[model samples]
Target: MRKISPRLIYFFGALGGLLFGYDTGVISGAILYVKRTLDLTALEEGMVVSSVLLGAMIGAMSIGPLSDKFGRKKMVMFAALIFLIGSLGSAFSPEFITLVLSRIVLGIAVGGASALVPTYLAEVAPAKMRGSLTSLNQLMVMSGILMAYIINYAFSGMAHTVSWRWMLGFAAIPSAILFIGGVFLPESPRYLGRIKKFDEALAVLNMLREPAEAQAELQEMKDADEVELGGFKELFSKFVRPALVIGVGLAIFQQFMGINTVLYYAPTIFKAIGMGDSASLMGTVGLGTVNVIITAWAVRVMETRGRKEWLLIGGVGMAVSLVALAILTNFAATGIMSYVTIVAMAFYLIFFCATWGPIMWTMIGEVFPLAVRGVGVGFSSLVNWGANLLVSLMFPVLLQHFSMPIIFGVFAVMCALASFFVKRYVFETRGRSLEEIEATLRDRANVAEDDSVVAGTTPIAH
Candidate 1:
């Protein structure tokens, strides 16, 4: 048998993210028609969109244990099956409630993919290449979003009812691809090591790395496995607390910063600003194009620039872009401002896709100790999706009650705060092995304990 290329492994592993992006993003276009067809009130429309998030929270919470018990590869395959079922169910829904339910099922798969893909990629990739290779998940996600935008545009010419169905049903194709491709992908060597399948883990590492490097990495994995698999107890313990804080903080900051408003409602925003349906959807395609381009660029440069720096730089750009958007909407809400909205959105995506967008996922996958990596990443994803749900459900409500300036201004403030969050908490993970990152967390935890003792206070244990 011909040896499989590592690139093929990365491609299949990341395909879940493509499904994640498509299922989440296709709604941005399909909601236009779904609202009209269902005569959805703003609250109902919000439900239709955010119900997926409800399922995502469930999936995120459950996936860690399931993936731990069964392995990452199996859970990924399971998610693909859910994607297929949900896509068909969504496309053929006969009523509003059914459509919402279908999307909830889809959200479960989305949530699982969101947590699993980054973790899987991070585990499979070598530390030297980990940042970029792990970032491939984000790239596939952007590609999926871009594909959804194009499909939405293509189907925009059809009758409203039919177009939205096609827009949603297109997801089945990629889900099928992911399912088929996952069959050939190797299991994560780290996971195999964790399970004490040393021979299997070494076999996989050998396939992916130079002989000397593979042996060394396998030894590192074996050493890391000295700690038993962690549960909630270990996760909340003092030793792991800082990594938890960083992962959860990144998750919250990434979502509350308002990139999704642009992604989920770009067409709606343009439509509100007086663009027609075709023009509005076209505007989103432009945003999606920018998203894919910048994210691909970010992947190439991720190692050299490092996570923390790009995050800070992107934060400034995002804040400025949101501020410009607030001003633009306040002073010139229509006509040429429609074009300006697209431009502002493009800048926001450039900053986000290149920095927080990929890095958030990448670091969450990196920050946790290997013993609890799956659960740590899953909990972070749960928070991320929860923030996503709140923002998604509340965005339309906010639009109803507030002016665009107020909404965007609020988002700008959050973006600035995100920069502060990064500076205060995030450490550089560039070019570091996962074990090395975990060791730093251990060192920080120990220092905190020492300081507490010196200060004459017993450290509170989690």
Candidate 2:
């Protein structure tokens, strides 16, 4: 067999992300037609949108332990296959309930890919390239989103009976590609070492690293395994608790910042501002383009400039822009407000794509020790999807009951709080080896305990 290049591994192995992006983004457009076709109420529409998240939460929980046990390669390919099945099932669903069922099935693949893809990238990557490689997962996600936006706009012109079906069916193509491409990838060497396949792990590592470097990394993996392989209990230990909080907190705040509210419902927002269907979808396309471009640039510079700085920038940018957007929506309600909303959204997405959008996944991949990377990411992802579910499910209802300004005002506040959390909690992981990060977390946990004990001592008030 030919040796696999790191480039192929970086690109193709992240196929799961591409499938995830396209699958999720396509629904935004599909729902426009599906809601009309079915004559659905707002709650029913939210259910159609959020059912996938419910599946994703369950899927995120299930896939981690399985990947840790079966290997990342197999599980990723499995997700691709499941995604394809779900896409086809969704396209053919005769009614709303059936469509929701299909979306939940597809959501499993989305959640699995979300958790596993970055973990795979982190494991194989040299410390220097880790952030960039993991960010490619985010890149593919943005590309998938962009691809979906274009498709949705193109298909919107079709007859109503078939337009949404075409939009939904388009997801199957990328799912097929991911399934086929994932077959050619190697298992994570860390995972192999965890299973005691020493020789095989070394063999795979050799492909990714120079002979000397490969052996060194293999040793590191062995050491990591000894640090408590698949140690779920270890995650809550004092030494590792902060890492868990950072991971889960980042996940929750990422969603609460309302990036998905924009991605999943940009067209709806545009429409409310007086744009027609074609124009609103085009607005999404513009935003999607920005997402891809900004994310691409962020990953390239991530290791150079660092994740923490960009996250702070994103926090400030999102909060300001969302507040601006909220205020502008009122102008839109009564008068022309195109430039204001577009410019504000552009700034908001630029910050998010650069920081939280990609950095969140990149950090999650690095934050956990090898022993619990899978489960830790899974837990974080569950929070992410759970937050996503709440936001998507509530947007329509909120719109019906509250003003756009108030809803986005809430998002802006969350973004500000999320920023504060990042400055206080999220550690910089741009160029650090996963093992180095793990060691730091372990040390921190130890120090925290020591601090507690010393505080309790008091020396009899002497």
Candidate 3:
């Protein structure tokens, strides 16, 4: 195995994340312009905002098998092309339908990249550095958000009608970079192994690992490959049930905490709390800034603190922040309470950035075995985007009837429950090879079986 520079892996992985960030965040700014120019009603506004998520749900659901069959690199390139077309189409969209359609396409690209990129990074990365390298995805995403905010602010006064077009159009630049950058990236070694292209897999592994390690890694992959590959039915079969549960659970929990609601509508939320339009915009920028700073901190702590610990910390923090936010909202009649809400939001952002935001992706990428990784991550991502759609679609309605306090309170309880779920169900994969983790799970299961037999109890399969 030839050893590649860590810098190269980090660069490519971060670029994939940049695409995720740019595509997802760009819409938040563009929707305002789109709604205004089209004279959209509440329903129309919801459609415009939720359309991309609908596309993402479809993309996330379907892209896994495509990535598995076609190779991660090719699928990513295809996604970039989709994003390019979506960006251009959205920028020049003359009608509501066209804009919605364009965003759907962008969502597909975003969804595919979201599922594939972290899996690709985790597969190629050395075990010791995997957390840090994979966290680049989140960092790039936050960077993309920050960049979008900056771009929107810079173009804020440039003929309001066209400014949104420019915002949507700007994504093309990063899409092009991702397309070009992806060309040079090697195919995932696991994908190669799954296809029985052992020599090619070995060569790719050699690039990422020491020669001795590469040889052993190849053997381990081959042993694991004995399991069935592909097909939706395979995902539910006895052997793969545990993996399916973890993947899907992670996906749903990641979104049910209401992170996207905060990300997609931070400006509006701040405005509702008494800030002027300009101050609200600045507040949104502050949210993005905090997101980026804490995401970087997550990358650093990921390896040190481990995934499970960070998740616990983040979940606790998120719950606390949300509760505080709810309290502030309940007291909004007092003008000073707005500042309290801002502080609560900042804390929420910090918790999310440091824990759930990055760790969720990293855990999803790591938990699945290579044999079923594509379907596992794909389905998980599908659930993720699906949950995102639900949140985006209902946030306006929830805000209208329940008040911010009730809405955020619901999210806080959900987050706290997620933390408990993690402690009970999530296994630690830190500092271990994929094969090693798989072996441990198998061993643990076997031990339970033996103990069950001796005690005359039924052993849980998972």
Model 3 ranges off by over 4 Å:
1-5, 223-228, 333-336, 444-462
Model 2 vs. true fold: TM: 0.96
Q: What is the TM-score of each candidate against the true structure?
A: 0.97, 0.96, 0.93
Q: Rate the local accuracy (lDDT) of all candidates.
A: 0.89, 0.86, 0.82
Scored against the true structure, residue 428 in model 1 reaches a CA lDDT of 88
Model 2: residues >4 Å from true position, as ranges?
Answer: 224-227, 333-336, 456-462
Q: Quote the lDDT for 343 in model 3.
A: 82
Per-residue lDDT tens digits for candidate 3, residues 1-462, read 444565775687568678778777766666667778989877777788889898888787778668877888888888888889988998999999999999999889888878887888888888898888788888988998888877776677787799989988999998898888777777888788877899999998887778998999899888773654666776675455666777777778889899988888877787788886567767778888888998887788789887888889989999999998888888743476777788889999899988888888887887776666777788888899898888988887777788888999999999988998888878788999877876765676687688888999887554
Q: Candidate 2 on 1-462: residue-level lDDT in tens?
A: 347887887788788888889988998888899998888999999999899899899888789657877889999989988898889999998998899999999999899999999889988888988888899999999999999999999999998778999998888888888888888898888888888888988888888889998998888777663644555676676666778999999999999999998899988988888888998899899999999999899888888877888888889889999999888987734344685788788999999988888889988888887777888888889889999999999999899999988988999999889889988988887767788887887677666667767889422110
Backbone clashes under 3 angstroms, per model: 0, 1, 3
Worst 10 residues of 2 by lDDT: 453-462
Error of 2 at 445 (Å): 1.9
What does candidate 1's lDDT look like per residue over 181-287, in tens digits? 87887788888988899888888887789989999998887776386777888888998888899989999989989987688888899888888999888988988
Candidate number with the higher lDDT (1 or 2): 1
Candidate whose lDDT is highest: 1
How well does model 2 score by local distance difference test?
0.86
Superior by lDDT: candidate 2 or candidate 3? 2
